[model samples]
Target: MILYIEQEILLDTQCQDLYLCNNGLNNEYLLISSSNQCSCKKVQAIFCKYDHDSCKNRCLLEEHLLIKRKKQTNSILINDSPANVVLLNKNELEKNSEIVFICHENNLPSPILEHLKNLINDRSNATPNPSLHQTLIGNFLLKHSVLAQSAYGMYLKLQQTRDNKFQLRRHANIGYLLANILLGFLCSFILYRNFDLYQLISNEILIQTENLTTSIKSIIEWLMHAPAGLKLNQPLVDFLARFYFYHIYLWSGYLEVLVVTVVPYFYKILFILCLLGISLAIGAICDFIRLLTIHLYCFYIYAARLFNWQIRLLIILFRLFCGKKQNPLRNNRLDSHLCDIDQLFIVTLSFTIFLFLLPSIFMYYAVFTSIWTITILTVKLIQSMNQFLLQIPIYEFYLWSTGSGIIRGTPRLSINYADSTEDTVCYNFNFDPVSFITLYRVCNIRLSLFSLSFSKLFLGILKGKSIV
Candidate 1:
């Protein structure tokens, strides 16, 4: 069997012959070659020996070389003295490789070498291909419409205000921002034109606020008694229920007054927001809604604080019961302690009271927390929609779809082998349009209002930290 292997050799003026020797590994050979006598037959023999185990057919060997000459040397000459026999692994050969042009004359023509150098430099500095969306749209337009082709040609001749990718992105962002502002104005005008619709929306908001207050009051009353078939401390439940009821009553009264006085002028406030931008306007609306329902957030805060306080007291009392006290000098680590009888009695009493009251407090906390979370999520969804509108690249998408090269991304290089001769090679260079998807991925802010981990949120609530 015969084997095939590929290898690179470095040739210079001083080297002449080549030799192949096995390096005592599986199918690996070290080639020791000089410039003068390196030929096809010797390379094939080396390959056959390298793959002797698996192949019994003919072998093939191909060699590619790029050489560089010193400025002082004009002609190739063979050295009579033993050429330097430096053994190189693949990595060393790659590291020491240099590019040079071989010619029939002693020296290569300066024009040809300079042209090759220019090509290499141009290739290295060329822009990358356009984004995926741009390419797809560009191709579709180019394939189907002659009118699009003419328009694109005209667009290409027009001087570009945005000459680079960064400028293009900035221009697109400004366009989107202006578009959002215009949309906000349109929305505000529509609301202004339909006064009845605005009145209807205002009434609905007031109605929703009233309903929420009533639902919360009902929930508090139900919790005041035994809830979910669980026996709770009546005194503690009564205190919490009365506290929440008073706050809800105050909030409802405030809403009632606002409905009569402020609801009629709510569109004026929205029109002021619309002057800013659609995203800001929408975000303001969300904030306004949250403000109207602020009572729920207040209830959650009260319950969380009460629950957290009881839990902390219970933990300290538990440690005291276990005959341990936290030592301030030892970074608060628990240490063994013999408690006084009076202290022990107080600890036991406190722990029992806190433990009994915990269930009632916890139930309120959980209910209010869930409601607040849902409200926050709804607000975040609206805000995300606003953000999407503010960043969407509508203008760029239209330009790309019409085959306008103004939205070009990286320049693409294609080799035209059909145009190449023995003495010359040809290359074609064109710019691809930047994709909208790529821009969105890079520039769009994440839509989430809260990206907290579940464990972190749970711990925060337990510690009486406000999630908002």
Candidate 2:
């Protein structure tokens, strides 16, 4: 079934035996008297060269030619043309010979895979090399962001493949997200009944609804002093920031409720673990969900013109009821200064930039929890260990501040704070991961949004400075 693609044969890729090969690899130089496959001098000047780089280019050119031939004629030509194609051997290698494949080797045409089962499926059940797995998993995790991924996540990322599929696939994101969401709901239900023991000790004052409303009012008032010529949609900015805060506050409130209830020490520990898991799951789902939400928001904003009178009426009524200010840029067609499509594009770009810089809060929480718990236990062990272990601090904690420098920062997220008067700035690390997550989220969005001052002022509405 060897597809010695010497003659101009359109790849009726219906056959699995079809493969592309070149005569140049079998010889030091490739020569062609026929001009049907491009001119001989064109081949002599470049294609015939005994260089790996040149051969790669030649193979590409050959594939291109084959594709072109396929288009001109749909049938695979069976005549012998000019080729010294060798056998499909992986082991045979010349001093500088290399093979290039244009087709997807993992997934041949349906019938073809069946025919080449012996050749392709031979390594199906073979155990992957431990070192190779380690190398790949290590590189992938480090490349993405190590602080945001748990050890179990790392294991799944390194798991063996099925049906010879690639280790890297985009669909995995969808499944990972769905699993997290499902797990969150499951935990919520399970905790509701069997988990009555989460209450421990907490009497701290949580942010009240009245406080949130006051903050919003003050924030809007402070925006007037924002840099002039800023084109921010003040209402939108305030809304987004408030919404982000609300989500954080919701999670914090739940945690607060849990802390105030009474529970045993073992249940308390179990609750902490479950709490961390839920947070991590939420963090994992955030990226994809956020991306999706952004697009949906953009779609709504950009596609407002498509809405009939009923939807438009509802929106107008809702705005009136909520006391929303009339947007000067409102338009049924293009916006006052920006088209809907253009605005959507700009929104997407800004969101993408922000997302890239923001660290996963849940992942960070998991790591922090693990480290804090380990430190608590390890310190006790150190007290009994030899002098080497005794040298380390036990039953204590330390504090440090971050400066406005690239190499230094509290969360290491950013150094561009609104107030830069302080020589060194240290953020308070909250005992509650939820509260800390709130702070982290605020800092990241604020810094990132400000950094985009040169771009759109979409979120620059700060008529009041009293929000904090």
lDDT of each: 0.53, 0.30
TM-score of 2: 0.21
Candidate achieving the largest TM-score: 1
TM-score of each predicted structure versus truth:
0.59, 0.21
lDDT of 1 by residue, 1-468 (tens): 101111233333232223343223333333433211222122223212122322222222233111111232211111111111222223321111111211111232222223223322323222333232278787575333322332332232121212322334345556666677788789878766875676687688778888888888898888877899889889888888888888988998888777667766776777776765666567657666766767778888887777778788888899999999899999998899888999999999989988988888889988998888788667656755765665677656665578654444343445546533343333333334456664444323232222436687678866766666
Task: Name the runs in model 2 displaced over 4 angstroms.
Answer: 1-83, 87-214, 217-468
Worst 10 residues of 1 by lDDT: 75-84
Using lDDT as the measure, the top candidate is 1
lDDT per residue as tens, model 2, 1-468: 122222222222221212322233322222112222322122222222122344345546654222111222322222212322211112111100100011223433222222223223344334344342267766564333212333233233234323322211112322333344455467656755766433321232223423533553454344323323444445544554465446445545554444345224434443443444443433333322333223223322222222223234444444443444356556443222333566556555654544432222222222223333343333223322311111121111111122111111111112224312232221111111122232222111110100113122222111101000
Alpha-carbon runs more than 4 Å astray in model 1: 1-165, 196-198, 327-331, 404-435, 442-455
Question: Clashes per prediction?
Answer: 14, 12
